[model samples]
Target: MIIPVDQLNPDTLNQVIREFLMRQGEDWGLAEGHLDDAIQQARDALVQGNLVLYWDENEESLTILSKEEVNQSGLG
Candidate 1:
């Protein structure tokens, strides 16, 4: 579910993003710091308007993806 940027509360939204990255770190066998880096990258993408944030009901988590990239990934 894509959330409009204006609809999110920044502090809560960032916490959700951080939690998602930490979970991804565990899934990907990445170390602690790696998750932090990934979260930072996602934020950068959001700032650049290259990505948007959404909630995944299945995973009960937040995710980030570029609109075009997501369409190409066949995951959305």
Candidate 2:
């Protein structure tokens, strides 16, 4: 299930983005240095609808994904 970023509290939204960055491991670029900046970037993506939050109901895991991924996964 996909959750709207707006549906989350500010703190929870930030935590989700941070966790996603950790899991991405530099895949989206430089997950190591300047954590705050990276997180802000992710937040911007979410605000712009370029990124979305996905909840894996069965596994009870949460993740961030691009708009294309959401579409491809039929979660959009």
Per-residue lDDT for 64 in model 2?
90
TM-score for all models, in order of appearance: 0.55, 0.86
lDDT of 2 at 53: 86
**Local lDDT at 5 for model 2:** 80
Candidate 1, superposed: residue stretches over 4 Å from native: 26-37, 56-61, 66-69, 73-76
TM-score of 1: 0.55
The C-alpha stretches of model 2 lying farther than 4 A from their native spots are none
lDDT of 2 by residue, 1-76 (tens): 8788889999999999888888875865664577788889999999898998888888898889999998987987
lDDT tens digits, residue span 1-76, model 1: 7776557797876786687666666643357557666767767767776777767789997676677966886655
lDDT (Cα atoms) of all candidates against the true structure: 0.69, 0.86
| Root-mean-square deviation of every model | 4.0, 1.5
